[model samples]
Target chain A: MSALLEVRDLTVRLRVGGSDREVITGTTLEIAEGEAMGLVGESGSGKSMTAKAIARLLPAGAGVEGSVHFAGTDVLALSGADLRRHRAKVAVVFQDPRAHINPVRRIEDFMTESLRTLEDVPRAQARTRAADALEEVGIDDPARRLRQFPHELSGGMLQRVMIATALLSRPLLLLADECTTALDVTTQAEVMAILDDLRRDRGLSMLFITHDLELAGAVCDRTSVMYAGQVVETSAADRLHADPLHPYSAALVQARPDVTSTAERLVAIPGRPVSAFEAPSGCRFAPRCPHALDSCRSTEQVLTGLDAGRVRCERAATLRGRLLDPTESPTESEETADA
Target chain B: MLRFLLRRGAMLVATLLVASFAVYGALDLAPGSPIAALTGGRTPSPEVLAELNARYHLDDPFLVRYWNWLTAAVTGDLGQSIPLRENVSTLIGQRIGVTASLVALTSLIIVVGGVGLGLLGALRKGPVDTGVVLVSTVSAAMPSFAAAVVLQFLFGVRLGWLPVLGTGTGFADSLKHLVLPALALAATSVALVTRVTRTAVREELDKEHVQTAVSRGLPWSSVVRRHVLRNAAIPITTVVGLTVASLIALSAVVETAFGLNGLGAYLVQAALNKDFAVVQGISLVLVVAFVVTNLLVDLAYALLDPRVALGSRAS
Candidate 1:
């Protein structure tokens, strides 16, 4: 009835070369019951780091501090049996299916083992459930597919298997980190559609992390734009596209190419993303923002907004009246915000 | 596969031919004649020495002598041992059973014990495991001869549980004498195999698939044997194959220690008495066994892992 997963004030730091390198800065977000949230950011924007933190899959060197509340359990406080029980509730579908499966194991055995292990189901029951899950993920001929090995299957098919294995647990939250980035365009679409259908059918919430803003907007109910390890803006998927308050989000939206529209050249962001160790003191995006005032350079902005959807921008006051209509179709004729 | 076998067979034949030449050359290089050795370095009359040399084909030029020996070898006639006054092949045939039994037992000890202890140490990863690895490393560091002497002192002289020497007693009793030698021979191999298995297993544990399994909440044991162990086996097979050559060489020491009438002992006796035929036969047998064992190991690698056969694309 309420939020399915809530992440609050999450920060993760690692000691690298005698310095405390913060990989994920203080960021807060939530996914409501049966609602999907897209977290869009470039490679070093801490999107994947945040997802791994939520799953408690960080390497040994990492130090995590935050409360990830999923299904009323404080994910950080849970330990031992409590932690394991909560982990079973939040499943992760990694990017590479080959690295995620037992190479020597047949697809059927691997799937059945995964299903049985997470749920404590009997072997025979697990096998039946695995086939059913594979079918749910739109794999044709589930029986034969199960018999095949990971090496024998295509990347898209393997990814679907990973998704099926994750879905078999009936998890409340699915953390998918660039799950289709390694596949071809056609395979990506097929896998995405399968995921979309599975999410709708199961009424599951997903934290879909990716670098593709268009794909995120197309699939997510809400989108959170992240920059250099902080959530810079959050709005309804359509609103974030039309009225991007944060300069970083605006740059991201501006960078996307439109096949149906016309632009002399796609405007790319000026610089590569700053490394986690070199994150700026003030607003991390301020250096790149053309609208940055003296205050934007001197002081860090806090995430503040009247609605749950917020933007960490000091220029929010000036930008509020200029916001575009969320329902406006993505056409070049729409208001350019011209900032 | 057929092409591979054909190439291997050709190479094996060439290697044997080269090896035969080396053995013949060594015999030809010996300082004194067999006639002199038999006559205790006496000045044998020219007619008598010439008659003996002609009988043994020493009168022919080196190439002709070698060619005659080669053709004679093909027909299982390796001339005769002057000192023993016996057919060279019959002497070898009589002695080969003892040598083969010794080599076979030693090989069994190495392959079985080494792999078993290695798997154990890798899995346990405790003090006991550490102890096994430590002992193996130390044993591997020592030469087989050194290990043989130490084992002989402990088991043969002090323990008095087994026979002391010379393939003593009945077949079972002779086997009992071989046990200590075999154990000594296997000691290093066990250490090596265990280390290999442990390293391979530990590395496999860190693989992403292993983490994926853990994330699924599968029991650790199932993850290891079903996934990690099988993948770890590829490298271990390579090491095992390479070790066979050493294992065969180490058998020489074990055979000598027990005074068994094996190839190593026969070769030594033949060399001392200037019995060229016995020396040649022993060398040929050793080289053939070494090459054949290597070939078998390579074949096993192909069988145990399809990736090696399929050019790693299957991986």
Candidate 2:
């Protein structure tokens, strides 16, 4: 499949207070036509920044480097009407629906505003379209729902409303930025199911950002694990879950508690996560990697092709099968044998 | 909504009653008596004193006297002004129009200039924002009386533009006459509203819904108008309402400074002459204005914010 969106070496520096902080550093990823790509990371890992950069929604005074090409157009270079047109093609559904919807405005206004303002659709036609969109999201009584304000709906209903609103413009790509993270578990599953069904039926490409690895694996075709603002690994979603190549990716998979078999404790990656600007020199994950060698600390890791996937670790070849099992500690004999 | 309004109306009546009692009691507790002011502090003959006491019910207990004043006030008879020798209600009626007109003009200036400048400052940061902040801070710091002196000197005395004293007879003339005093009265309030709106709009701009609106590919202007300003309206309305209400009280200083024959100026003159009936009558009117203004503000809050209406319904 051809790539619908290509973001290469995109580095973003935000001017915070007086100093400039690099939020995303040399991040590269792509979404193929009709593909769902999951971006997995901890908080402050720049997943949301990447999505914002693609949509041209970065805060003022932010400095961006590298290219974001959407359907042969340079997204970063777009301005005025062209920029707005680009945004219309890329819809975003944020985490907290309550926070992202105007509390005072009715659902119809929130949903139909883009159609009415951007496309100049008539109010009556827009309202009809909004009701249809609400129905598509499994909301009953669409007519009544459209007239209700955000505060009148529950969080899950509001999220569905937001999803329905995102789909109104027939966007080519959907940016779901932790869209289900704010919902209850059951509601999360329902919203996820609705999102999956919509994406499949509409052939819409998506960049789904989430912290939950299993959730990403369930809905995404491919997954990219981000660490300190860089893509640490990109591979088939199930394969990433089964055998994660990057040390950080492997650590994340192992951090999940298994329901099939009981473990004494869930494995957690050592040390706190660092932002791109605060990351140390050389390998950003070297300080926390359990399999790090002396050379790992000195060599800066770049995303290099290994097998059918990409990984940033220098030791991916030797440590492939050994990283998954939590019981087996890295032994000196294995290291000597590899050497 | 109807129930909420009815409850508020009842509360308003209760508040007015308490306020009237306080005003009457405080005035009564003052060192001098209405009898002294009526008599010009001269020793009266025994029969004359008896007749004066009998006529004004000066020999009645405090509660009985308060009840008498309250009953008369409720019926629109605010008793006779001892010093002015005029009906208190008639005096208030003649001056009320001037004060209302000044207040209306001042409110217009405040809403337009304040919201406009505030939106400008918030949307265009850097130098314009800094300038707005600086100017508003200075103006807010300056009291209305001080603003009155400066404005009167500059526009009235120095510039020889706009009238400085006496409310004019007709609409155009009255507006022209009241301009300086209104500016003086509205200066601090306008500054206050400007700062409040600026802060509120800036805060609303940072909210997630505004970001969502911008991201939806709606025009930037539409995003600001429909999302940011609409969301900011509640707080802006609240500040504007409070400033407008307080203008009734603060107008006294401006009226005195400009020599306008408004209710505020009449109030000052009455208080100075120890005209108890006039003072009480004006105080009651001021209290009623305050209560009714607050009621309107609450209703405005319901109109501006659906959440408030919903919450009130739930309660």
Candidate 3:
């Protein structure tokens, strides 16, 4: 009820080899008003697909089912003018800044194109507003820069330009799909700060998708961890760091490189990330989870309350404090018993 | 930019010079003399034959003769046409207007009309796209000569709606006659432009910028005009340039079929009568046209793709 964007049991099936294979299976998420939700997952884990489906930007042949309700309006049912209005309201800043902006067009042309075309904003006013938007995103010499093409700018600068252009429509929800992934470490932090500042200043809702756990924890109000195309666990950003509910979340936390760790080797996940097809009939992460039991492999997962947000696990209540020290190796006796 | 253009200009000069040498050498090695063509191949006394050879520098050494022609060509003297009994430049020059007009019309039909259809086909995917593909494939498969014959049969003989030969008298009348020939010349290239342009537009449409534009609430038409077409222009320009160049040579078949006294027809006649000066001069012009066409295509390509243009300049 508190959410601005509520994706209810959304499922996306891609046509692969003449059959519809569900890439995102009933994945649900919500972003509250003026709040940022971090969607963290490895590549092919359906993080992008979920965001694209919500934005109605899925390619032809992608079958989308389930309801996506934004501001109490059915997102899936909107079309024509309503759909365009929805798209303008829900702006997306993609992963690669260069990939998403026409290289042939000047920054001014790109920034003012939508505003002038869609809203009938006067060209001069649009240009002035574009300059201001650029200035807001820490871009200096906005006037001079606007005349330049995307290739003329650095990766970070191009990303800032993208953000500036994205804000021209004055969207309510900014879907930043790894907007800083292609940037260097320093630029990534700057872009994230710029995004955070803009979100707070404009009172906007954001769905910040990225694989960087630390970044998500630091920037987002709440974090949702996806596995095999489903949100395995979602909790307050701070709580996700201190105590992750699901095993996959815990494993992801353990795999993060830490400066203070005293272990001989870094903790690694048991296997490669799985696609929806390779996912099991039961708990999707059961094969990779170190704490998996015989029953865990055979039973379907359901969301169970853990903390501020829900987790997809059967024994969530019982496994409370036991999953804390995820990096600690199993005892010799435990390995021998399994053998 | 100046440096790039200068380099291309230099390349043009070098190519023309090389072409002149090839044209000169090939004609020398070719059988039959300019004497036979000028004298109607009748039995001539040795003294008369010697006089004609000396007059045309046919008896001069290869290097001296080529050097002489090269110098004269640079000064706008393209040698003498033995068959037409006039300056090679004047003979080709008079008909240059006709051929140039034809080639320009064909290029227009291919680029504007063909690419417009291509864009429409790409924008509308189901039946419209299928129809465009089917039409383009059929057009591409139809040879220019066969196409000329077919167009003549349909429009000229049966319909009597158009002229079957000649460049016509006035502008409008000329255009009337130009239709079938232009269509015949344009068919393959129209098909080529349509297919390549459709592919280019489709590829550009798949790019994330198009998606970005759409997501920003811009209509697909606006997105296509602003983003997709601009990005697709480079590849389409390349195909059009190549097609035009190839069309220049292929026009000979169309010209002979229609009995037009254009460069293509002149070339065929010169080759048949062994009018080496006219043949050599026309060949040089065609080579220069092709090179210049490609050069312009490259320039246009650089404009569309700033990476290559700006990157080289930046460094």
Candidate 4:
């Protein structure tokens, strides 16, 4: 399948006072049409910045570099009127709905104006479409909701409203950056279910950015683990879950809470991710990786192609060879492999 | 709402009582009595002094004198001005219309010009924001009298575009004379109002809802006008309410400097000549103005935001 969106050597630099420093270094990735890719990282890992860069939404003080090819057009190269036209095909949902909603505006104005931006529909027709969008997201009585202020709605409802607004544009790519992190767990699950249903029904391509690996695993078809300012690993979701090759990815999977297992103790990653300002020289995760060698400390390991995946580690090939087969249970591996 | 009004009314009565007492005490403690001042620091004959004392209720105890003055004040029968011998009520009546007009015009200028400039400075950002901020700071730093003098020199004396002093002309000409004084009074309030407005808008700009507007492909103009300004205006209303009373204080200085026939000028003249009844009458009017202004501000606060009313009710 051809890639729907290809981000190649994307770099973002931000100016402080007069000096420029890179917020995101050269990074590359591809998303096939109807694909869902999860970008997993802690805050300040440039995951959100990358998603924003793709949407061309960074503020005036920041500079972006790279080729973001959406369909056949270089999104980063689009300027002025062309950029405004391109906005109809792409949409983003922010992390907080309350912060994004206009306090004085009724919900109808917010939703209908957004629809008007991409189409020339009459006000009534646009409002009807907004109501339909809200209905699709499970908001009851959209008519009553359309008259209320942002403060009148609950956090979950507001987020759902934001999602509805995004869906109204019929965007080719949806950039959702930690969209459900502010929500309660039950609400988050409900939102995720709605998003999953929408994607399946519309075949919408998405780049989902979040710090929660479980959340990413639940929704994304493929998961890319990010460290500092780089994508360190990418693997198909089921394959990655069954046998993660990179040490960082393996640690993340192991850290998942096993609700089924009656184990008395839970495992966690030992240390924090390296600071972005002083990102490690070689493999970015080498300092935190248990399998690090002297060569791991010296070599700048790039994401080289491996078995059905890519990993940025000097020992990923050898580690893949030693990985337990999918047929083998973890209980058997626990007897043979050392921590 | 009724409870809010009741509470505000009680506070108003207490504020008026305290203001009355202070006025009575200050008038009574003056070096020479109104009687002696009227007699040019010369002692009158026993019979004349006795008649003057009884007419002014000077022989009564301090509290009785206070009670008499308070009663007459509430009844709109404030004896008479010692120097002019005109009824204090009539003198106050003559000056109030002019002062009220000036205050109303100045208020309109502040709301329209000040709020507009503040919104402009906030939306423009960078140098435009900095320039407005700097100008407001300078105005806030300079006293209202200095502003009045400077404006008088520029617009009145130097340009010969407007009259330098006096405001007893017809309404139109009074406005022409009132311009310099009004600008002087409004400068400080406008500076304060603009500063508060800018701070409020800047804060609203950082909120998540504004970010949502940006993400929706909305124009910056629509976002600032609709989304940002309304959210910013809630706190700005409180700042405006506080400025109302200070506006009168500013009016007093400007009116005196420009020789306007307003209550503020009457106040200065009364204090300078120690005309106790006029001083007491003018003080009572000012106190009532302050209380009424505060009541109106509370009402405005409730009207602007239902949530404030609801929250107050809950507590």
Which pairs of residues have clashing backbones in candidate 4? Answer: A99-B208, A99-B209, A100-B208, A100-B209, A101-B209
Q: What fraction of the true interface does each of the listed models get right, in terms of native contacts kept?
A: 0.33, 0.80, 0.72, 0.48
**Deviating ranges (above 4 Å) for candidate 3:** A325-339, B50-54, B310-315
Provide DockQ values for all models, in the order shown.
0.34, 0.75, 0.65, 0.38
How does model 3 score on DockQ?
A: 0.65
Candidate 1: tens digits of C-alpha lDDT, residues A201-304: 98999999999988899889999988888998988897777778777887788688878889888877776788555877887886777566667778988998
RMSD after CA superposition, every candidate:
5.7, 2.3, 3.1, 4.3
Candidate 3, residues A257-317, lDDT tens digits: the string is 8877677888799888998866898899988887677778899898766767799988666
Candidate 1 residue pairs in clash (backbone atoms < 3 Å):
B114-B190, B118-B194
**Whose TM-score is greatest here?**
2
Off by over 4 Å in 1: A17-20, A72-74, A77-90, A102-105, A115-149, A168-171, A321-339, B1-82, B85-141, B145-203, B254-262, B310-315
> What TM-score does chain B alone reach in each candidate, compared with the true chain B?
0.90, 0.96, 0.96, 0.92
Which ten contiguous residues of candidate 3 chain B have the minimum total lDDT? B306-315
Best by lDDT: 2
Per-candidate TM-score against the hidden true structure: 0.79, 0.94, 0.93, 0.86
Q: Candidate 4, residues A175-251: lDDT per residue as tens digits?
A: 89899999999999998899888877899999999989888888999988887888878988767767787878787
Q: Let me know the DockQ for model 2.
A: 0.75
User: Candidate 3 lDDT, tens digit per residue, B1-315?
Assistant: 888887778878988888889988998998877787778869899999888877777787899999999899888889887767789998888888878888999999999878998998998999999999999999999988999999999999999999999889889998888889989999889998999999999999999989988888777677788889989998898888889988788888888888777999989988998888899889988888888888887887788777777335431
- Pairs with backbone N, CA or C atoms under 3 Å apart (clashes), candidate 3: none
* Residue B157 alpha-carbon offset, candidate 1, angstroms: 8.6
What's model 3's lDDT at B271?
Answer: 94
DockQ of model 1, rounded to 2 decimals: 0.34
Best model per DockQ: 2
